[model samples]
Target: MTTFDKVVELLVDAKDCEKDSIKLESTWADLSLDSLDTVELVMNLEDEFGIQLEMNESLKTVGDVVRAIDEGLEQK
Candidate 1:
């Protein structure tokens, strides 16, 4: 699956939320995820993508996460 698709799956599985609500523009607040949840999700993304991610405040939306993963994969 694509990066966005994988991110969506991870978020849905972790949060037990619907896939329809997880768009690129969707923010953490929109998904009802707090800082702890965001941290766990980042760990999951690192393991899932086999890439390290330096957590940042700018990553406020799902699209940002996807972009980070894509950039990580590119570096690998």
Candidate 2:
């Protein structure tokens, strides 16, 4: 699957959300994800993609997470 698809899957699993509901512009708040949820998601993404992802205020949307993962994978 693509990076965006993988990120969407992770979020869907974590938040029990519908797959179609997740979009690139969807924010953490839109998914009802709190700090812990965001941290866990990052850790999961790191493990899944074999990259180090730092959770920060800059990561405001699912697209940001996908971009971070894509960049990390490119560096690999």
Candidate 3:
């Protein structure tokens, strides 16, 4: 699966949410992800992609996370 798909998968698993409910436009708040959950997700992404992510408010959507990972990959 692509990075976007993997991120979505991780989010779903991390939040214990429905897989079908996750979309590119879905917001972290909408997914019920708190600060701790976001941190956990970031750690998972870091481990999976071998990139560190600065936890910022700018990442409001799933697409944002995907783009961040893509950019991180490009830098690598």
Q: Pick the candidate with the highest TM-score.
A: 1
RMSD list, candidates in order: 0.6, 0.9, 1.0
lDDT of 3: 0.86
Which wins on TM-score, candidate 1 or candidate 3?
A: 1
lDDT of 1 by residue, 1-76 (tens): 8999999999888888689999999999999999999999999999999999989898999999999999999999
lDDT of 1 at 30: 95
Clashes of 1: 0
lDDT of 3 by residue, 1-76 (tens): 8987899788777678788888888888888888888888988999999998878998888888899989998999
Per-residue error for 48 in candidate 3, Å, reads 0.7
- In terms of lDDT, the best-performing candidate is 1
- Which candidate would rank higher by lDDT, 1 or 3? 1
lDDT of each: 0.93, 0.88, 0.86
User: Candidate 2 at residue 20, lDDT?
Assistant: 89
TM-score of each: 0.97, 0.93, 0.91
TM-score of 2: 0.93
Considering TM-score, where higher is better, how would the candidates rank from best to worst?
A: 1, 2, 3
